[model samples]
Target: MLNKVLIIGRLTSDPTLRYLPSGTKVVEFGLAYNRRYTVGEQQREESHFFDVKAYGKMAEGLGARLSKGYMVIVEGRLVQDRWTDKDGKAQSRVRILAESIRVINKPRTEEAPEELSEEIPSEEVPPEGPFDMEDEIPF
Candidate 1:
């Protein structure tokens, strides 16, 4: 069986970081994704909101970096929490248990400082010159 999910979305609000009694770090945040589609000559846009959680080093790292309106890529699995409410009715909701997160863009706020909005390097660009077989690759 395979249980994996990948989503690219913007943060709905600042991340909340906390620690359990055992001192394990945990971070929770809300993510919003937009979907656009055309149906019978009409265009429609839909937005989805999700609750995301991360643990340990990843959670600690994101706790300091993530904020409202920051675009990010979340890779993780789905989790469902089930319980009975005060009304004696069962309640459940699904959320993402983030294993990894990548910030793809800065926050939309104009007041963000240039340094704070600096792009996080995603991948190293190859050299401009043509590759030479004899040249050693810097792996």
Candidate 2:
């Protein structure tokens, strides 16, 4: 069985870095993911919110570089947090335990002015069409 999860989305809020009593570093943030799909002739889109956290050195690095609205790629595994609620009932929720994080977009400081358009080479963009499932991914 596999439990790995990979997600690319925008940060809904700035990352918060904290230190545990044991001196372990951790960072937590919210991510907003959007998906678009075609149902028959109708196109539909939806947004999903996720709670994500990173630990140790990765958390320190991400906390310094990431901010609200930044696009990032997170690779990790799902963890179920189980505990007793205030009502004394058992509760559980799933969250991502980030093993790695990569910033997808350029940092805000280096971005060109909004009025300027950056032209990307045609080859840089993937063509829109059907794909063979058996084909090896270029990446």
Candidate 3:
């Protein structure tokens, strides 16, 4: 049996980055996913929130750049933790242990294209020439 999950959604808020006692970096974020379905007569939509966590370098880079409304793709496994609450009730939460994350889309803005230009010899552009097809039938 395989246990894996993939999700594509927008960040609900900026990722929070923290470190453990041994300085192990961890980042936590929530994703807002929406799905549309048709009911008996009308169309309906619902939004779901998923908790995600990234570790080490992935956590550091993702935490710095990810912000609210950013779209991302996450792949990971499921993890659940159980604990007792103040009411003497057992509470459990399932979170994702993200193995990898990739940005899916960028919001529209007036930003220039990122050009990675390298120094190269510039050649003169060739002049345009008119096409001549007079030979016979000028259709």
Q: Specify the highest-TM-score model's number.
A: 1
Q: Clashes in model 2: which pairs?
A: none
Q: Could you report the Cα RMSD, in angstroms, for every candidate shown?
A: 14.7, 13.7, 24.0
Clashing pairs in 3: none
How many backbone clashes are present in model 3?
A: 0
Ranking by TM-score: 1, 2, 3
Q: CA lDDT of 28 in candidate 3?
A: 83
lDDT: which candidate is best? 1
The residue-by-residue lDDT of candidate 3 on 47-129, one tens digit each, is 99999876677778777766887777787777665556777787777877787787866433488433322211212211223
The local distance difference test score of model 3 is 0.68
lDDT of every model, 2 decimals: 0.73, 0.70, 0.68
Better of 1 and 3 by lDDT: 1
> How displaced is residue 98 in candidate 3, in Å?
0.4
Q: Deviation in angstroms for 81 in model 2?
A: 0.4
Residues 82-112, candidate 1: write the lDDT tens digits.
6567777888778787867878777766675
Look at candidate 2 and tell me the lDDT of residue 76.
78
Q: What TM-score would every model get versus the actual structure?
A: 0.76, 0.74, 0.73
